[model samples]
Target: METLSNLECFARAAATGSFSSAAKQLGLTPSAVSRNVAMLERNLAVRLFHRTTRKLTLTEAGERLADSIRSNLEGLQDAIAEASDQQQEPSGVLKVSMASVFGMDYVLPLLPGFLTAYPKIRIDWQLDNRHVDLVAEGYDAAIGRGSELTPGTISRTLARVRIVAVASPAYMKARRPPASPQDLAGLDLIDMRSTRTGRLVQWMLRDEHGNEAVSPVGERIIFDDPGGLCKAAALGLGAAFVATSHALPYLQRGELIQLLPDWSADGGPISIYYANRRYLPPKTRVFVDYVADAFRDQDLAGRF
Candidate 1:
């Protein structure tokens, strides 16, 4: 047990590059973490760290040990957790990342039920519109549009995200409702600026028969956020292309109306991503299943 504790302290310090940072993560004082690492070095009879006031660097032996244990340590911890009280119920902080609007609208609503079911689990939900390196960033899970999968991570499809053209009733009333996507070229168009890239996103619309076409953007009013784009369209600014998840509430309230409903763009699946492990943590496992079930129950896949 002492050896395991020392290994954890050493691994954390190696990964974080500071005793203070490791202490913060492990709920120990800096001196305690430092002592643990020192004890580990003495037990192994190997110099592990090149320490200075400003920085901590691993020695050759330390780097080798860190590399060897990096993957195995989590599995050992999971094994330990599985044998502990966590086996009875899911517990610990489930760190999740999701888009702001979608998280608030969809996943956030499930929190009450989730908490009621697993009272010991704590939520560390971060809402942002960025592609995150799940393992590197220490995120237990992420929910958003599909991206290139990380090597040690896997994605579970929650819903097929569909992008549709929408406009306020007043905006459509003033202009002819687009019979085809080409008609959008003549009207004022709200555009979504790519959050990752500085360029305006071109809308590629597909019909029921699997035919596809690109809609031109006027670039009159551009927003980085889908919610903002929907809001702009609702204010009678122009027709905008946005995901169904972002447009659903507005459409329900009569704030926005779908145009050329037969034509929509494939925005890719909304997936919940997590580490691919031999033994998935109970907290993460339950959270993923809960969210998947919620989406299934609501028929979001069919709707979006």
Candidate 2:
């Protein structure tokens, strides 16, 4: 039991790269967690971590051991919790990741109700654009568009994100509105650079009639974030190709108008993603279900 505790501490520390973070999750002091890791290293006759004043990184041996024990450790913990009566209610720190705009616009609105219902389930939400390594990073789940189907992870799509061309109402009034996708080349277009690829996001426009045309990419105005792209368009900087969800609020406010409404592209699904494990933590399970239910009930998929 003592060895198992030490291993738990080591595993948490390895995942977070910080003794304090591991201790917070484990409900132990940082010193205690550090001591447990040190004890683990001694018992195994291997230095697990390369510790410095500024950072803590796993040694090669530590990385190998962490990978081997991750699933096993989770299974053991789940089994123990299942056999115990204390874990009936979902109560734990639920670490989640998502893009800032999506989380704030969609997921954050659902939080008040979710937190009120599951008062014991604390949230550790990370608003980031990068695709996180779910198991390795110890994240309970992530919400975003086009989440990669990484090994040991499963994604449940919430919406079929439709991409549309949009421009400020003033800009549209000044310029002859694009009569067709081909006319987009003549407009002062705002572009979104993909954060992952560091390249301009190419707009492949498709209509219900099965016709396809590439919307010309522009170098005049560029932004890495959808929010920035939409804002620039709203300011009449140029027309922008953006996800409907990203431009929905501006469109509703009449600040922006949809262009070539009949033509749009599949922007991929907005999904809730988690590790594919045999036994999921109750907190994670409930949060996933709650978000899915909210999307369905509100018809966000159809709206987007």
Collision pairs in model 2: none
Model 1 lDDT on a 0 to 1 scale? 0.87
The lDDT for every candidate, in the order shown, is: 0.87, 0.88
Query: What's the number of clashes in each of the models?
Result: 0, 0
Error of 1 at 103 (Å): 1.3
Error of 1 at 263 (Å): 1.6
User: Which sections of candidate 1 miss by over 4 Å?
Assistant: 13-25, 29-61, 85-87
Q: Which model scores highest in TM-score?
A: 2
Give the poorly placed runs of model 2, Cα more than 4 Å off: 13-30, 48-68, 85-87
Taking all chains together, the TM-score of candidate 1 against the true structure is: 0.84
Instruction: Please provide, for model 2 over 1-304, each residue's C-alpha lDDT reduced to its tens digit, 9 standing for 90 to 100.
Output: 4478998999889878999988877779999999999998988889999999999999999999999998888888878866763547888899999988888899999999999999999989998788887866668899988867877899898998899999998887878878899899899989988878898998778998999998888799998888998999999998999999989999999999999989999898899999787667789889999999999998877768
